[model samples]
Target chain A: MQALSFEQAPPPSVPIRFFLTAPLFMLLAGLLLLIDGEAVMASRWTPAALALTHLMTAGFMLQVMLGALFQLMPVAAGANLWRPSVLALPVHLLSAIGAVLLVAAFHHQIAWAYQLAVVAIGCSVLAFVPAGMLALSRPPGTSHSLIALRIALLAFFATVLAGATMALARAGLIDTGWLRFSSSHVALGLAGWGCVLVAAVGYLVVPMFQLTPAYPRWFARSFAPLMVLAIGLGMVVLHPTAWLPLIGLVALFASVTLDRQQRRRRAKLDATFRFWRFAMGCVLFACAGSVLMIFNIGGNAVALAVGVLAILGGFVSVISGMLYKIVPFILWLYLQPRVQGVPPMTRMLNEQWVLWHLRAHVAMIGAALLATLWWPAVYLVGSLMVVSAALLGGQLLRVVGRARAALRLAQPS
Target chain B: MTDRLPPIVVDARRLLPPEPMERTLEALDEMQPGQEVLLMIPRQPAPLFDMLHNNGYAYTVESQPDGVFHITIRQASGD
Candidate 1:
């Protein structure tokens, strides 16, 4: 049997930096939506809309995903990253800067912004991809989550490369045809990188968090790889309906997840459970919209609504839900030994704040979906976005503050 | 060489992470010839088993009905 080390979790600071920084980007995106509401709702190709979309996807969603990947890779797969804090700091900084510059480049069409974004994001990919792959390469066992993580990382690399190419094209350093790859790029980023990682982590956390039955072994093993193959073939075939099956797969996973929540051993419902269930429902609704769009039944507005559902409703919902649980858990885990009388993990954050955030988040998703059809609804969307981000960021910051206070009390003066 | 030696007992069920595994490894390091270490834990220490086996130790695990795991580790005979 191969030797494995599961005792290699990095210091809390490593992932915490990414988590604390993520919501600020969402807040920035919200501010942009407020200022450029009309322009953003006009069309997906509009510069404002493009910038806002990337802010959510690359800025907010990608930040959370990077943090979670570093934390999850070790525990879930026995794949410890070498010198995680050292490797993660520069990557996090560059990725955050890159996400901002990328959005600015889209908004202003500035060549310098695009060039800076290319360098910054490119360097981030350069640092993260090899480190991530190296971790996955040495897993002691071939668990489904491990396989899914491997696929997600590979997809992430491809997504970064494609995105960099498109940025260069926008900068006029390359020809116009790179825009043609946008559909395939979205497929790789959202469906490939986004879906696979969520599915993999969901399989691990859903059971642990809720004390529910494990996802069926065969389905867990097969779903992600099959989705990757489907996305790849869709790109190659360029068939109009080729991507439907991939969407269906995601919808199927969502159903399984919601079902698992219903059967949870712990009857007391928390804010996280509500967030996850809402996210899964949004995924199913998004799949229905996608099927309609694929069949040419709706206009560009319907298409835009589908993207909103996937990003905000599905990804943001789940990620925020997880932060409520994960942030407190990490603080408790690290602080327990140092502090003489640390609070229970459950007491780390007020449940009221999470409930408020969830309410705002649900409203934001609904308003964003409506705004796709009626441009005036952008006001509601933007306001809710601001409220939701503030609620999340403030809660997380308070947890960190409390942990710091506890640590200070633990110290001998 | 055949004299009976008492096994070192380490109860890890009440201890949290790193401490539980750390003390077990410490016991294993101090083990002398023909001596064994017995550990009581809430869950099977899966990672430690691989490390012990790879480092030329033999181990046995017995899971009790109450969900406690009793694990014994010794240097492989003749090592």
Candidate 2:
């Protein structure tokens, strides 16, 4: 029998490349969104403002999250999907086109783009459904991460459908939004789908990469219900009200509790831990901002603040820190097999890269939040965020390069 | 004399569970009247002599210079 060789497998398919490239797209999308925001308020550009939202959600978050889920699920669940390459090609193409058209349609007010985006995104979800169900249907002993992903994907589908319908309304295909359609989309997309996936991934990634023990069962068990309640209640209220506060309360309580649980992890604190803390801080701020917006205490600015807090502040911190581990590990997993005892994957990349990105991510987050208050310095913060995100993306790609170089050296003559 | 070695087949996953493997102990207890069993393991998880002392199965564990080991287990105890 031949020895195990990691490099024997051909390169990861297009879906993987698309995923690895997502952070970069997010930087560009975010830059555009911030510029558009500046233009919207200044009357320099007639902007829907919703384009900025989709640019972040569909452009940044959805692309990265979906790709990561496809790769990680097989490994964690031992599901060993029979045709990962086949699934990735079309999924990436469809989703990318969908996100682009959606952004164009809404931002430029092009009706055809909106219709095309709906068909593309809806088709992408349909392609994913069977693979997701097959992976989830397997017997017990699957990782808890996979279980969370299955549920989160359902929420993702719901969020997409709602958002597509709202887009149709924008195209005059439907009369909506006193109907609470936009609010429903935000709840499902941000709070229901994105929040749940983030929290669930935190459970596995934090422990696996950081060498921390499992999250306490209490927090893990509490997450699903709170996420569901937040989405369900938000739909009922459709605006900031007493019921909305209840949703915020549950979400805030959950974030605080999760932070406390993460703190108790005694692994001699690293920057990843700092990311976890930062995410919690953002979550708490988002809760306050959301509730305030619901009460009409701060006008519509509160929603923008909440959006920035959740996306740039919460998700960005978590993903950047996690990449500190994931990039190096992927490098080591594929390369270290050839080196055979030279250095571990963590040694290949150091904590400094994480700290570097952390500062940049945090700085940009500060600047973006500042933009909400000043509205003029949006790009200054956005520039900081975009540069930092781009730097982090480049570093991850470099690890892939390093892995490929090592494999070339080991191939038999 | 130089000789060719046949490729050995092993089931990797089956080896993981049911720890503290005892080849002689199992062979002596279950060998079909004078039948012998050949055991191949990377390393013995349980002591071979003690396994024989406790069960009195006929066996020999031949340690190879490389990692793997070979053991011959013949029925010698409980029938």
Number of the predicted model whose TM-score against the real structure is largest = 1
DockQ of 1: 0.09
Indicate the residue-level lDDT of A128 in model 2.
78
Model 1 chain A weakest lDDT span, ten residues long: A1-10
Q: What's the count of clashing pairs in each model shown?
A: 0, 1
Candidate 1: segments with Cα more than 4 A from true spot: A1-6, B1-79
TM-score versus the correct structure, for each prediction: 0.85, 0.75
Provide the lowest-lDDT 10-residue window in model 2 chain A. Answer: A1-10
Across A104-128, the per-residue lDDT of candidate 1 in tens digits comes to 9999999999999989989998999
Query: How well does chain A score by TM in each candidate?
Result: 0.97, 0.87
Best by lDDT: 1
Mind giving the per-residue lDDT tens digits that candidate 2 earns over B21-50?
322333434655556666665444333434
Give candidate 2 misplaced runs (Cα > 4 Å): A1-15, A40-48, A80-82, A141-146, A177-179, A237-239, A242-246, A249-268, A338-343, B1-79
Deviation in Å, model 1, residue A372 alpha carbon: 1.7
Candidate lDDT (C-alpha), each: 0.85, 0.63
> Could you report the DockQ of all the candidates, in the order they appear?
0.09, 0.03
